[model samples]
Target: MLREFLQSHLPQYLYVIGRPHLARMNYNELKIHILGLFEPTQEFDSLKIRELLSTDWTLKLTDKAVEMALLRYWRQGLLSRTRRAGRFQYALTERGFARKEWLLNNG
Candidate 1:
């Protein structure tokens, strides 16, 4: 059971070890990471994004920081936001998708 757990979870830790700066990412780095989290058809609110960043990326960012980034992306046309269930859920737009690809290649 321990082995299974390690096998399942080792990669996340390994990733963090490989990229120590994730723990202290600046805004542009944070934006790139947040952009990578999106799927073309999926939407995520700030809280959900924050949780994923914590667990998957090993990033410990405040709720306000994540929300502000999301809002900034929305305003920049990189993401689209909609109010649902009293929260703003954000998804990637076409421009954002293109930007993600470009960043992955050049950034």
Candidate 2:
């Protein structure tokens, strides 16, 4: 089931690269990749987002790095968050959604 899910959701190009190490990304690139993960109305916690970044995008980032980025976005009003079960659940704001679409389209 995991394999099937990966096959369905992961892009063909990521498989071709054999899991590239994307840790050296620039700020804008990192923002693009991270923001691209969310749907307009979807919410995800930090750990789940980190897992998706590692498994789907082949990014090897520390938990703190992801958390810091999320916090930054929250501060910038690109993300909204609420405390849930002792953790924060983050969702993209309208600005974030627009930015994600712009980045995807322009890149």
lDDT of 2 by residue, 1-107 (tens): 32344344445543234655653655565576678777888999888888777764456778888899999999988899999999899999999998777765554
Q: Tens digits of per-residue lDDT for model 1 on 24-65?
A: 554455666788778799898878888777764345677888
Residue pairs in collision within model 2: none
Candidate lDDT values, in order: 0.71, 0.72
Where's the lowest-lDDT run of ten residues in candidate 1?
Answer: 1-10
Over 4 Å off, model 2? 1-16
How many clashes show up in model 1? 0
- Relative to the true structure, candidate 2 reaches a TM of 0.76
Best by TM-score: 2
